[model samples]
Target: MKYIKIRIPKATVYFTPVEIEKLLNKNIEITNKLLTQQTEIFKEGLKRGKCFIRSSKQKIREERKI
Candidate 1:
């Protein structure tokens, strides 16, 4: 009598549930830090005589070709 051997392939995942959660938390922390730094810079710019001025709109007689 001859017996046949079969092999099954196993599926591999790169990120498990715990790992994904850690990654997401780290990304959120980094983003919050960056936002805080940017806000500080914007506040300083506002105090240093930086202003947003609207440019005068000009009437265009020529039509733009799309």
Candidate 2:
């Protein structure tokens, strides 16, 4: 048997290449869409006062919960 490994911020998981490719493609598609409409997205978020950040402690807590 063969394996593929993915290292996320707080966790690692193994997947088959096909699964990884699918995930990668999906993420790329979503990212591209977001970029195309980034201004509108930002405007909407600003209107709602919503935002996100990369938080290590939050990642650690989520990983521990998982």
Number of the top candidate by TM-score? 1
What is the per-residue lDDT of model 1 for residues 16-63, given as tens digits with 9 covering 90 to 100?
566767878999999999999999998988766433322111122222
TM-score of 1: 0.55
lDDT of 2 at 29: 99
Q: What are the models' TM-scores? A: 0.55, 0.47
TM-score of 2: 0.47
* Candidate 1: Cα lDDT at 17: 64
Off by over 4 Å in 1: 1-13, 50-66
Off by over 4 Å in 2: 7-11, 39-66
lDDT of 2 by residue, 1-66 (tens): 567987999999999888878999999999999897998888888866533443656788899999
Model 2 alpha-carbon miss at residue 21, Å: 0.2
Backbone clash tally (model 2): 0
